[model samples]
Target: MNFDAFLHSLTSSFTPVIDSSFNPEDYIHVDLSPSNALLNQVNLSSAEDIELFLENFLRQNQKKVAYGGYLEKRSIYDRSEHFSSGSSVQRRNIHLGMDVWCAANTSVLLPLDGKIHSVRNNKNFGDYGPTIIVEHQENEQTFYTLYGHLSLESLDRLNVGVKVVKGEKLGELGDATVNGNYAPHLHFQLIKDMHNHAGDYPGVCTKAELKFYSSNCPDPNTLLKIY
Candidate 1:
């Protein structure tokens, strides 16, 4: 079976990646793409500005979690030079992971049983701060799950090859000061191939490279089933 089909077969119901106390109803789909006119009113460069926007968005929608953005073309990345390629067409703004926006320190859980593959502190600006990659094998097929923007303390106890079960507490979300200077959120992604990457992988890509990146990194929602 194909990767997408394999992911779908792993779960028949909604999978919680954060605070299990929250019901699936508590999550509201958020649009962070450039097409969202509402974003134009806020300063995308400021983490505080983005945080306030998310706070208001969740409050207004009566939801506790705001999630979406797999393969979404976002303009927020423009604020950081890390995503700039000096050419508009080559700018890396297409998000490759599903972002779960909520309060800082929120518990991030594993959606599937896996073992710790690698961990690192990717301290680059506009990058995933404390990241973890978990390796999984089923039906003789091996794959990986990546958790990014985690609290620094989360890595204090993690070790390679540590066994973690589905629904296990992987880590807590980090604040802006540590999590790539963005609003607090979990950047969750699935990878068919690690490409020798450890605790880090390109979570965004330029339009010209979308074809390959999109195929290597599938939509995370296929496993989360939050939509």
Candidate 2:
């Protein structure tokens, strides 16, 4: 089976990346893509503005968690030079992972049994603040999962090669001040190949790079089964 198929076979039901107490029904699919007309009213550059919009969104929907955005083209990146430093054609705004938006400090849980591969504090303006990557294997095949935008304290005692089980708490979500200045959320991605990367990988790609990146990073919902 191919990588996407392999991931689907690993889980039989909805998988929670945050607190398990939240059932699948608690998650509402959110649209951050440029196509979402509502985003046009908010100030995309300010973390506080985005947070307030997100709060209203969740409150109106009566949901505790907001998720989605695999392979989604977002304009929010336009606010940061980290993604908008290049020409228009070279701008990297297509997201390659699934974002779980919720309250800050929410527990982030492991979706699969794996070992800590690497961890780092990417302090760029629009980057993953505290990140963790875990390596997993099944039937001789190896893959990886990335958890980004975590609390600084999450990396305190973590060490490379430490074993972790599914559903185990890996860390808590970081706030705007530390998590790339965005609303609190977990950027969860399934990587088929690390490409020698550790604790860091492109979570977004430009249209020109989509062909290769879309292949390397599959839709995370394939494993989470949250949709």
Candidate 3:
């Protein structure tokens, strides 16, 4: 489906990714930008530091969940080769997905009806560990969604052609060490075109490729509606 039509469908058809306790008031929408003073105050240069930061931040906010980081320029990515290893011209910082920050092992629900398209363990520093991709058909158009940084146990019993009902418990968020060595969270992305990619897609891209990827992967908030 084209971007505009796909967005309309999500509003009507998809369920919340975290359905159990989804009151918007119970969660804080965070901005992980360079100017966020909290990052500097904590010296967030390591995965452990991030985990601690999120913990304290959530406690202070009187919320159990903290979510954001879509299209955000994050410094946390500097810890791994996935973003900074590339040449200066190709350096990637813009996150292409909406992160659902919660405790590890929190269930990740399927937002809509779908079938498994591919699955793999993207086990690199700052990568999607035990990623799962699902293909959905609506209005005679096919699209895909990627769920990243999932627990290793979540991979069990998944098959390429198996159908998953909307609102079903599909997987759990992975721990920091397993989830690309970062704080526990779910990286949820909606894609119009997989671009022949499977089990993996660029969750971040350089400014040079922003125009194309932004269209290919529209703001996940169209489905998430978290703000």
Candidate 4:
């Protein structure tokens, strides 16, 4: 069944900022460019300092941290990875969702009232890291949302079939070690069917698979509306 409209109808309610009492909605939508705090500093010199800088910055600013499609779709993939050896254009795919780059303990809220269908630790570098999937119903239509790069402890308090309400704080984003082995960030994606699985879904898509993935994973901005 075509769920585009079902998905579109829910867009009007997504708040760009989680925990807005502490963090403002405007700050969540800002693009802090070239800041070492947001973008990783590339320095051939002092690799140790670079490591320290990422860890320190992540610790301090994981909350209120900002980065998005500053130029074109820079907030998303850079298209630097090789699809093959030498194919064609290095497709710089546009990012459909907003990323909340912050510390491990930053809390994530349930965007809407839903039931916990599945939860698992992806446990791979650059993976969802730790993930949660929720099945939600609005107007008798059922859909899902995937929350990735979450803290390990978040799963400790949850179980399958748990009922979560709108604006309820679900879990915190994990650290670099557990969160896909990169800088800490929340990889949130809204999905329709989830294809009857749990614990994970493709956070990134390839050029060849763009058409299918795009439809399968509709623009999160529809729900986020942060931009």
Model 1 per-residue lDDT at 201: 93
- Quantify all predictions' global Cα lDDT against the true fold: 0.94, 0.94, 0.84, 0.63
Q: Model 4 clash pairs?
A: 62-102, 62-103, 126-180, 150-174, 151-174
Q: What's the CA error at residue 84 for candidate 1, in Å? A: 1.9
Give the lowest summed-lDDT range of ten residues in model 2: 77-86
- Which of the two, 1 or 3, has more TM-score? 1
| Model 2 lDDT per residue over 14-102, tens place | 98999999999999999999899999999999999989999999999999999989999998998789997469999999999999999
Global local distance difference test of model 4: 0.63
Model 3 Cα lDDT, one tens digit per residue, 23-125? 7677788878898987887655677778888888889989988888778887777767778745877788889988888888899998889999999999988
Error of model 4, residue 19, in angstroms: 2.4
Candidate 2 residue pairs in clash (backbone atoms < 3 Å): none
Clashing pairs in 3: none
Residue 20 Cα positional deviation in candidate 3, in Å, after optimal superposition: 2.0
TM per candidate comes to: 0.98, 0.98, 0.93, 0.72
